[model samples]
Target: MSNNVLKNLKPYEVFKYFEEITQIPRGSGNEKGISDYLVAFAKEHNLEVIQDEALNVIIKKPGTAGYEGAPTIVLQGHMDMVNEKNQGTEHDFDKDPLKLRVEGDMLYATGTTLGADNGIAMAYAMALLASKDIAHPPVEALMTTDEEAGMSGAMALNPEHINGRILINIDSEEEGKLLVSCAGGVRVSVTLPIKWEDIKEDKTPIVIRLRGLKGGHSGMEIHKGRGNSNKIMGRILYDLQDRVSYNLCSLNGGAKNNAIPREADAVLLVNKEDVEGLKAVASSWNEVLKNELKASDPDVNVQVEVLPDRYNKMFSKETTKKAVQLLYLIPSGIQTMSMEIAGLVQSSTNLGVVTTSKDMITYDSATRSSVKTLKEDLVNQFKLLAEVVGVECETRADYPDWQYDADSKIRRVFERVYKEMTGNDPEIVAIHAGVECGLFKEKFGEMDMISFGPNLYDVHTPDEHISISSTERMWNYLIAVLKEIK
Candidate 1:
């Protein structure tokens, strides 16, 4: 094959396919175009492909030469990427392709995510689909959907649709590691009523905006000492209330529960006289937080800007006090570290999203862990907190955790294969975040599974990038294992 056929093909030819797929918009819940593209590519290669009702596409490649009798293996990954961006970026994920750039050995986007989490897996599958010379057993490519959000497609998967007993999930972020277990997750939302009172006293609209925090994965980065904007904003408001009389008008921060809140904004109607004092307080708090979170979030910015107009109907005194109290009392960040796995977080919660409307102010929180009892216990803790704060709590989309299976045959096979290939033992660990493996295991009981992937750093953030050399090594390792399996 000519090198020109693979335009940006570096050490790993699969990255070229990944680059092509990056040009197409494959955000969660909007994967029709990408799914169609995959189907077309499969048909062009004369491969047998099936598109299920859920838009899941499966392409099957027959065994190569004398390896026909070898057991089949299913290669799985999601087709969608999380649409997240930085504070002041003007990139549209739907219409524009990912602006990929290479710095040193890392491949990243200009102002958006590089989409290598599953894009690499999709590329690897495509490479397997297109390759004819590589010797391997029967191959089945299962491209799932909506994995970043809630594992909607995986949960919806019918076990009767797939035939492979062994599945290799290529979604782990780190390299040289095998993941056999992952945490479950649940999103809890608290809605509180607003009591707006007409302000007899004149007040100015002062915006307290929290930005420049290095927000990261709520699960993996929770113990890394980064500050949550939602929590910090609550602390600021709680302290400001003691010093000055302010009305909470509007507050907004964060979008997804799995990501730490980077930027938050609150428009508060404060007494005109206290503007200078509030600004001074904000500056002092910024300095304090900068010193505290510099190890994790170096650019912690907290600014208070004065606005010209006041809120149409400011909050009554009673409502303002209660709202600030609730914000201070909400539980966020890592609650407890795991006892089973040393240095692993067992339970954590994030106050990710906060929004204000004319009628009410609502805050969204998500709690996650590998232990089911601990996860539920955290939810109940939040419920009690909300009750004392006088807010209605609601839970949604609870997913099962993939408990660690010590006797899994797939893990043993991967460990042996990795040790033989690299001459060093790979790290085996259980993650605190949720993966589709849990849902798949629930559906297909007794299915042998393990997840591994190339080195992907800063996932779900604008800083997200993947290593080209690591990807090449990963491909070689996977091919070696696939050929070794009988």
Candidate 2:
């Protein structure tokens, strides 16, 4: 089954490059293949290109005709995509190409992310660079790596390598909305050691699983009030501690540090007689959870299954108590709402992933805020929570926020062109999620920047998709903006 549905799409060159990109695996931290491919494309087109040590690619194209004297414009987007899939998708993002499909006006992949968040930016840049008729200024197309995991490529870039003073970032998700600023973020990891013990006499093994929740991008969808599976499991375990005697064997959930967890599972050893009681408790909690999240997650499921084989080892009673307490106490979801912006989320955290190993259990979270002091405060909060439980916590991949520029020349050009084309003004606003524009601004203080993209839904999740008609419209709008540049 070839995922070549874009062959007959309109705006042939844009979709053509997108189709080619989808055939390559370019997940974060594994972008060498795609970076090399971009270099090869530039070479084939007889253009100047650079592939940095961090695998970031920059392709330079001369301006066309009368536009040769115009100022150079930088077209920026990341080459990496978040690799997320359903529980049993059987697809390997590190090796297999995405399985693309078209339904109505949208394009999506089977049981996985479509990567359109930034991939379409690369496609648009490539198409424009390869064109001979489109009027534009000198172009520098910058494709970065490891952006989903962190802004490592952007962080590694030297300011001297880029000469463009006007930058247009192609990483936003909504159409007709120009992003002027964005929040900063960091990844936090906490580890707690536990002691293991032999299971007591006549104890049975059982598994509790939560699934079917509508997980989404942690930063963008945090305010949606959807249920977090890890949090749900914590409540269940806390309730079971008083009703039934059990020993925890293993606990795990979630994949990315930037996505809300949709599924979580736990294994436990309980006395044979307590199995039925645990099931009843799980059922009761399921009903309660459904009622609590009915408006957001209508399809949430909670299941319990008993195993024939018994587990030989389990966490000590003290360890079990501390683990449950940690999950219950740690902060997750929206922490604050913007008082200035009408409906924007100000500060937030996602308790993204949890895992257990032989010596320790680890919790990974992503926190974001536009205020530098508030972002640091959230990290301190996480550290304090871990300290109380005698665990260790650390932060990584800290990126700065992009502040809005009220006097940006490039933004004015974009707004003027959008209104002339659509007969309506585009909404200009700031986003809560992290974008690479912040790193660019830090490196080049005088550069003017703005971010925009086509309409996309459920980004960073399995249900991610891009609208075909909106993509064509965005392509036209980008071309119009380029023509207006001076």
Candidate 3:
């Protein structure tokens, strides 16, 4: 903890609270200690605290002496974070504290995610809890869990637990922006069965890996034109198999459902006589890919290594042909860009995870769209694609889109405050990525919501960093809005 509370309390002080939080591991669906810490903080501060069965915490601060009759406002944000690290990061997200570092005006963690997405919101909450000088209306600070993996905690919020109808979700990544809408999303899994056969063609088994792609959040960075490892590996196989007779053994890629796959590996048995032809085919495809996505994915790489293996069996010829054809044809990148918002993505799909087994293989992907009807149409399109490929398709955990509220009162207040603080109007926009605001609005009817935050870059990845200067600007805006809100 810092020595001073309010003296010279800039935005980085809020970030200091975030640095301390990084010491505690609070991954999705596992937020016991963090929850306890929050309750204890509320108790120590003499705030009214309520803990729900869903493990959601709401700490209420009664309105300032003069603003008692104003509407109660909810300051909402999630508590849990996505635990991710780089290829060689030694820090354990479960036990070790996040190593925070400062470079210029950016705050980042060493070799791991900094968890500033919601940690910033948590710090803002702590600042509010510690503040006795600021005059504000009745405020409810809601810290939820399991937001990174899913909106389970937000979905479980009891609408009647608090009397706050206006909510400000401090979870967005961009500063000087008001996020009034967000896309709805769901996960789809396609499973295909495979039959094994003996490798009778005197073939050599080789382990091939396609790695070093700059992976990012599937929803946020889909239009950045980065290469998907799953698609890259499939393309390599598709081209190589045409030049050399090969039997595929196994294919696996990616770890999470929301991340664009960064690496993929495949084992294949190829005849020794056709090795030269296979090499040439791979070279041609690599050149083609490098030329095609040079601007977006400059570091994309594909490598192969021969392995000594007595292959009992490989995928049956018929099954292998079907699998390869299906995987190669499935769309794994941005589908459409929004005509309404310049540089905004409307409909997109991500081929996130793939795994192969003896009997069957499973590939998981996600789709997102802010337009409800368009989302349904895209899901139907995916179902049709799966049917054509002879695979069983299923979708789960569907969440509704947070429709844009152009006339939202909360947005008006935020816009006025932002203008007053910076002498310029903030950008009021909608995000293509899904936010918990949609889930909360779905569970609780007619809740006015707006989301804003400091600038954060490359979240859910090892290169994540928070802009300290932007955090200061956002903090000033937040304070100004609190002072003006009725």
Query: What is the TM-score of each predicted model, taking all chains together?
Result: 0.78, 0.77, 0.83
- Score candidate 3 by TM-score against the native: 0.83
Residues 1-486 of candidate 1 have per-residue lDDT tens digits of: 122323554644587778788888889988888899899989999999988777888999988988898888899999999888888988888887887788877888888988897899999999987998888889899999888866778877778778888889999988898998888889998887898877677888889999898888898788887889988988898888778877877778887777899999988887778889888887678888889898888899898899977567877777777777767777888877766556777778888888888788888888887778988998898789888877799999888778777788778878888899889999988888888888877788877889999999988888999987898888988888788767
RMSD of 3: 4.0
Q: List the residue pairs that clash in candidate 1.
A: 338-346
Model 3 C-alpha lDDT per residue in residues 1-486, reported as the tens digit of each score: 432322243564575677667777888877887788888889998998998887889999988878788888889888898788988779777777777777887878888888897888988887776688777889999999889877788888888886888998999899888888888888888888888887666888887788678888898888788888888888788877657888889989888768999998888888888666666676566677778778987777677777877788899877777777767876677777766666778777888999997688888888888777877887787789889877888899899888777678989999887787779998878777889898877777889999999999989888899888888888878887887876
Off by over 4 Å in 2: 1-49, 60-71, 78-123, 126-138, 146-152, 199-208, 242-246, 267-282, 301-308, 403-407, 429-432, 454-476
Residue-level lDDT tens digits of model 2 in 272-301: 899999989987877898899999998898
C-alpha lDDT (0 to 100) for residue 254 of candidate 3: 86
The total number of steric clashes, by the backbone 3 Å criterion, in model 1 comes to: 1
Model 3 bad stretches (over 4 Å): 1-30, 40-47, 81-116, 126-133, 204-212, 239-245, 270-275, 301-307, 455-473
Model 2 lDDT, full chain set: 0.89
